[model samples]
Target: MKRAWKVSELARAEIRHGCSSNPRSLTHFLFTLKKSANHGSVRDLNVDADTHSSSSSSFDSSALFSNISRLFTAKSPTTLSETLTEDLAQEVAQLRDALARNLHDSDEVVRVLEENCGPLLRRFAGGSAIVHLLKQLDSRPSLALEGINELISVRWLLGSSFSFYQPKDFNYACKVLNWRRKQEDCEFPMTEEEYAKGIALAGKVEKVGLAIELFSEAANKQLRTTSTYNALMTAYMFNGYAHKCESLFWALKRDPNCSPTIATYNILILVFGRLLLLDHMKLTFKEIENLNLSPNLSTYNALITGYIRAWMWDDMERTFQLMKEGPAKPSTSTYLLMLRGFAHSGNLEKMEQMYELVKDYMTQKHNPLIRTMICAYCKSSGKERIKKIEELMRHIPEEDYRPWLNVLLIRVYAEEDWIEAMEKSIDEAFERKTTVQAIGVMRSITTTYFRSKAVDRLATFIKRAESAGWRICRSLYHCKMILYASEKRLEEMESVLNEMENSNLSQSKRTLWILYKSYLSCGQRNRAAQVIGLMCKHGYEIPMTVLPS
Candidate 1:
């Protein structure tokens, strides 16, 4: 007890001395002083040096000295210093115990860190940022947050982004109603404002993973619907996680609370189609049926498109046969695809037969699309198709310029040349209003031009397309690029390549190809090699043939 009093007095004296040199020291001194007041629990025998003394002789000697001192003892006053010393000792002990307990990882620790970046973050920043981003990319209207609560009416709806987050135009009434009911106490899950803002943020950002996480978290905490799931599933699929997409389908099936709708299977089948996993895709058709779900045209269309692109003719024919025989009806797209593929393959007879079938199925109102297909067929067949072309032209709806443009094909086919297709395509394009048919019809014409020798018309269309539509891009543009280069109009080729540079569309392989060819034709080996580096920087895998020599 005497030693503790001395220690406190010394510390105070040192603090007073250092206060002139450092003001912080005085503050620290005051903190220690406040702790010293509580000394009720201080131990009287506790002293510094004799804390572990155990010898009996030493203890007896100390007791004799203590008795001798008491005979002539000088009484010392108890001081505040002793109290502070006792309080400081207790505080240090408590601190050490607390440090030990904190070493374990626990939920509280995780929770504390996550609270900032977790639900609160989504609530504060996610909605507006997301909606803004989506509006920029797709130009689609943003969903109002208040309108989204209607999606959360069911338990499974909880994990979806759309339930808590949504497009801007969704009904505000249902949202307010649901929002009002969502509270634990207030009967609403989140305030209508929070819901709106979170969804808006979610829609705007490109970080789909974060969006999914935020949506999933919100969904788990409340009710969710299948529509909510579909939205998230779409986000996943768009990001190219095909495996995740497939799993989502089965997830719907396995969950007692969730059932896979036709849309769900359609999404799964589309993934398989994209992968060219014919066996897996074919199974999805049966799987949907076995699950007592009726397959929609979208489901059949995905399979048909997949087979057509893969050139799985046997599978295509079988699926088409089945579609024709069953409740499913083939749309114009079905016939158009068959026509397009067969035309590309130079199977003129099969092309003619497909065109005739389209004529039989399409009424006068729906026949323009079929006429577009038949015009494509006539372009491919050349002179033999002239008669068919004339008959199909008579059926073309008013203001459709397809036949006028295809006159080039009439010429080439009359001479049994493929180049006429391109001329016909470009010429006819001038007469038609901009529509989906215009592009396809143009492609059919140009592709035939490539098959023939219509270089002049091909270049014109390429130039026109490049000038239009935020710069013409797509597979067709690349095809046109190749065709122009192959014809060896070096000056015109470079012009098109330069136009591509300014366009929104970028496929580095195409860029590299044009760059390499330009350099090779100009005999600029040094420039060509540098372009090789540039291509690699843009993630273009240089072809093995063009690697060096």
Candidate 2:
């Protein structure tokens, strides 16, 4: 009788008052309804076919709510709040399920609604729903590939503005530029112009990979009277090609034009250090000492990260201590690598302490990602100890805060089920024009498109990226050519090869093989001969082939 009276009373509120406009009043009324429904001895109500049908029909819901309401009311008042919380949670869960079902079955409805949502829904779609929607359309064949192309094109143009960088921004900027460029042209070859741009970027960033390309392009063409072999050897070593580093080091020693530098020894030490081939590391260190080439800060960090990887924590600490006493002091990367290692090892205490120690420097250094990363970790663990971290960051001055903080804040609030919090952050961010960061924010989308063999989208992105000014031409070239081959587009590959030849962006031995396969795959023997002719026109040697009679 008590449960029946409570249900009728709650139904009476919904039928008359429904949910109110005022938040507090609405919360109370909703809470009352939840309590009334949940506190009811529901198992008995569900067991009775007539009562169950009558209540579910009244609520315009399924038997699920009826059954759960029974469990909540059967519990005591101390458990009442907990039980009511679970029952209320069901409202949100059902909404999510309904949204998903609508997206699955009502494409036209979602399409029309999402377009009007402006950028927020676009980000949500690109970030979450886009890939799933593509997968669903896979069996539709007519729509699947085109749908992905549309999704990626929108992604390619998604950002608001690309801005100037602080010192800490370079790493992230490079990652974004790299990701964006690859998205547009995973198989686009770096034009000689693009390679030149990369060389300029090397001067700015001191990225070892770009340095290797500069010397490789110079040496492969035998362009200068000056020796490039030593530079290539140094570059190969630094890039962690152990055998190539060793071979090139020996090759340079024999060549009169090139000689060893202290930087060379550091590279050699790093090459061996990374393998944690303790014997090789020691040998290189001993050799460097003999040659009067002192190990630098980076050399030590390399050894430390390597030791950490090998679970030689003692050696890692020893290396750290040695850095303190030696010519080199530890940098943030040295600490970040250690922190990541500790994190992987599941040492939360050490991770926390290291994070706190790095906090001030990371801020001064303008490394906003560390804070966002910490927030992610905290959220994953469901720890409210550092609740609303993104909100707290807003108190800092413009000098202290990064422009990307809004993006981070919205993402966190969305993931936390703090719907009210998410709405506020998102509205603020949109008003502030945060949609720009979502553009190519995910490199995985580009990777997915590449894997799926989408060339036009890749080409479109590369063109956009060039205008935007990324510096990873070699990476773009490597991927773009692969995309061509994947689609069995030989003429396109041939055209790129011709462009590469003209610009002097020499293809590696592996790249040449890919080109050859592209030619054969397209059944273009004559075009293949033309490629050989084109190569010979540039004085590149071609094996003479006898015509089969």
Candidate 1 lDDT score relative to the true structure: 0.45
Instruction: Give a tens-digit lDDT track for model 1, residues 129-196.
Output: 22222212222113233323233454434445334434343322223223323333521133212332
lDDT of 2 at 293: 57
lDDT on C-alpha atoms for all candidate structures: 0.45, 0.42
Worst 10 residues of 2 by lDDT: 26-35
Clashes of each: 55, 15
Best by lDDT: 1
Measured with C-alpha atoms, the lDDT of residue 146 in candidate 1 is 35
Q: For model 2, give the RMSD to the true fold.
A: 33.0
Residues 1-549 of candidate 2 have per-residue lDDT tens digits of: 456445534442342221111111111101001112222311111111221112111221122222222211111112223323443344334433443344323343335324432332222211112212211221121211112222233333222331222223122113222322333232222222222223323323434554455555544643211123323443343344568868867765564543544444545654565455777876777786786656665467556645654667677678888888987776555565455445445466666666665544443222223443443354354456336364335445544433355544545554454545544654564445444334332233345445556667656655544444332244455567778877776567657665556445687655555665567667777765665655656666555561212
